[model samples]
Target chain A: MKRRAFLLSAGGAAAGMVLLPQLARAEAGRIDWYTGSDQNILDFWTNIVQPKFEAANPGITLNLVDAGDNAGLQAIGDRAVAAMASSADPQADIFESFDPRLPKGAIEAGLYVNIKEAGLSNYSKINPLAFDGDYSVPYRGSQVLLAYDTTKLDPANAPKTFADLIAWIKANPGQFIYNRPDKGGSGGNFVRRAIYEVNGNDTSKFTVDNYSAEAADAALKPAWDLLMDLAPSLFDGGAYTAGNTPSLQLLSQSAVTMIPAWSDQALQAISTGVLPETTGLVQLSDLGLPGGFSRSVILANGVNKDAALKLADFLLTEEIQSAVLTELGGFPGVAWDYVSPELRDKYKDVIPTTIPVFPGGDWEKAINDGWYRNVAPNVVRE
Target chain B: MIIWPILSAIGRTLWLPGADGVSRFSLETYVFFFSDQYSINNLMVTLWTTGVCALLLLPICLPIALYLRFAKGRLAAYVQGLAIFPMFVPSIILSYAIIRVLGPNGTVDLLFNSVGLPKIRSPYLTPWGPVIGLVWDNIPLTVLILLSGLGAVSDQSVEAARDVGARRWAVLWHIILPRITNSILVAISFTVLGIFSAFTLPYVLGPAAPEMMGPFMQRTFRDLNDPTNAITQAVISFAFCIVFGLFYVRSVAKNRKT
Candidate 1:
């Protein structure tokens, strides 16, 4: 009886070894795209990008999974980082929206593919925004700009410089407000732009790696003085909005003449009649406000690495970029010169010649915290 | 589970790495918190909000709780439901709803404007914003707690007070108030702690500067990416909540002992 049981166990173990590889092979042909986008963008992928890409490249199934929220995407990113460290199967081929930094050394460890070096057809067209590194390829860009109601304020009279913007706020008391810097990016960039304006408009002076207490004092104090001087003219006499959307709501309600808001959100709001037809958006020509981009990254170790590359390349194609604009009301990753003439013409007025970029890490934290500490509530450094 | 997270958080606050490799326990976080003017402002705002919310919650909730506890029939049921309505709604939705109903050019403004009145100043982004929203939010739970405490009061106790020719106010003051002391303590303790720990309501409705500790900790942790200071801010908030929590622990223990 013992000999028979041992033989049976050995047979079962042999079968398990044979079935595991078969199960692994069955998943080999499929590529999974993980995203942290909301339902609408996920719908764009499920209903639009999936079918189109699948039809273009037959036999390779594209599995687009909505990873819920940003933290969800970050979880997958951490998992990929772990897998890369351990040289294990990542189980994910493409991360549609992902964090570029994780597990302390994901980017330096090269856990993600460098799409530009990957030699995709649309490699040159991708926006040059390696927020961490070339760990992710950007597919859409959004700039923070001044959103003003044309009925209340003339489009031609929009603030063109940081000085002009600050003057306008004081000149028109209780007619302008941005969100708290810590609350929203529109206000954050607005604060960042102001910091640049005061410190000789030289953004080159600040870097993610080189922030020091001395540098913060020299660069930030002037910005605080400027903001503190301009505080009384804010909405409700030194009131700021809660967030980007609330700033827009203030504009729509005609409570404020102008507000800082994302280009995509303002355009969508105006198109949807949430903001009136008279609302206009303009970027600062003098050292333009910093912007952000939604990007995709590929797992370095995946069975379907080649298929994932194809999808990443496909996402950057002008066709998908236009779809991103039309369907999601987002700025295309491809430059205006690369897009169709009609698409270019429609969005030409709002496009920045070059999107001003700011390094995050320590500098961003200091500016945000400083805005809270020194700018808004009237705290001053001795 | 609860103790582990709390202990871990408390440990994170105490972790101070020296210039060398060795780790040591220090009050560096506490010192930074106390010395930093912004952090002190946040602590003051948190304390202010707690005090105002606790004080205001009683006046608003006590009358309704009294009505719900003493009154009868369909009106009492409707009043009870109406009192605790904010509990069912999520705080995010409540903040948005509060904005629409009470914000500038909102329903109140529009209604007033239709009658040709001037637009009123909104409390939407002011310090009062959180206080108003918090009071609205806390009503349901405060009422529920007070009602449970009121339930323990016997009808015969009130009748005995009445037999001694005690008026309504006298009976409520001498008989009802004394019996439900533990309940009021519990309610205030719970509300104060909850108010101190509240995030969504304050973030949505409160001022940008001098924000409560919840937003302060979040901005420090997330926006500032200063986990040490964020954890420090949290430790400060936890300390505040613990002060409020003691009242509850004491109340529960005293009742248990009895």
Candidate 2:
């Protein structure tokens, strides 16, 4: 009798261990969210947002999976493409789309659901520019700006135009640094702005869907000339740092006084003590820098389509947008008037009058290739 | 299962439809990769770094492995422990530690300044940086392999050589080195493979241009969005690796035959 009782108890315990999780899962449906943001954003979603969201909407759990950033974005896109190719459900219900062109491609491919039909309450309040057709909802935005150390530079003397910036770089040799164009978007933004300036501030020439090699060569000649001219004045005489973080590191260490950086990342770095508090940002008046919105897309064939739409709506709420601004230093997805007054006041000086989106795929590739081939060799010291 | 995916990748590389939506087998991708001088430069840089890494590591690891094999003391134990400790540390963390120690205003600069020496710029932005990091990160594995070979060496053979009036250097050159030829080949094979395919070290330490094959391929695939060219680059890297791998196989087979 004792042996039978022990065996029965052991079997019962094992059965409970296996079945309990399934029961809990059934009670609390899971929604997988894939993000390509940094650790702080991940923690905010897991530690703060997940618990509250779960509490308010019982029987639903938020599964946050950090995909990665930059390269991580590509990985998520590749997985989505593979799933779509096989006629299978994507791994995640909601995915953070970092590249603007990716969402456009996915939408065209019919891989994303039309969120406008989901009847999200906050969708109407979002900036219309943030919407890509009816498929994606913008989560955050960041602009590229010229960031400099106040200790090494005078704010009054900050360059207000592209010409002034180039002159400053020429005058202050080894005091400016920008990452390689292919490495990060910040350096690419600087190059694009120069291209815009060289075309007599005409933005329409390079924004087309089809790449014209002849037009590109004609427009990019002056920009390449400017870069080659500034080459001798760059940090280490001509060699650029590898990425955005390295350029910022050079700024913090006073090796270089100014660099083009994403406004949000630069501010976040300052607040987190990665950069000194004396750092300041300025938007050039004559030429606009490139910036874009980060959006969340719902997979058309995701397991939890309704839940993903609900979560995306929650991300656009005023309270959540406020947290995005304060906690992550990201611009709100809503209009400036919709954000809190204090947030506007805090970022007023650094904000540009216009934030242009990156050019379409064909033009972008042409510019990147052209810069590497025609300009990089002439500019790089080694 | 693994073969399926490998075959699928190869098929994609050979015959996958491109942006134009045309499916055909062609060497167009390979031609594109080689057409650019920059791409050719990247290939050369990758080979050069791999060669430099192996050349530097052989002298450094062999002496340490020999010492660890012959020495008997707490000092030898400590040396052994120190040599193996880096293997446990992640490559990312090790790269950062190296940057801090060797970067401008870092410990190395501070030491130089304290001695009234001129401040030296950090080498982290140059090719030397990745070469140094790769050599350091790979030393432990190389030493471990050499030590294993040293263990297989016969003490009696060395004693016999000494009894026959052979010098110490002669014994080492003829007996010890010959016995460990296969092990050295294995170590060289691993070193070449690791350095050729290294990403984080070169990405963080090396210059923006002339990137090693690993990071260059990643950029080409993802950033450039040219999967065809990326796969071709991978195929090239794989071909180089197979050459070394074949030598390794032959060495092992010969040792078995002997």
Residue range A17-110, candidate 1, lDDT tens digits: 9998546531776997788877877888988899989999999898777789888878877877787778777788888776667546776887
State the weakest 10-residue window (summed lDDT) of model 2 chain A: A21-30
lDDT at A239, model 1: 79
TM per model?
Answer: 0.86, 0.78
Off by over 4 Å in 1: A1-29, A36-40, A66-92, A97-138, A295-306, A379-382, B1-15, B159-165, B256-258
Model 2 lDDT tens row, B8-53: 6667788868679998897777787789788898899999999999
C-alpha positional error of residue A112 in candidate 2 after TM-score superposition, expressed in Å: 11
The collision pairs in model 2 are none
Best by DockQ: 1
Q: List the residue pairs that clash in candidate 1.
A: none
Q: Over the full model, what C-alpha lDDT does candidate 1 score relative to the true structure?
A: 0.83
Candidate 2's displacement at residue B138, Å, is: 1.3
Q: For each candidate, what's the DockQ?
A: 0.73, 0.34
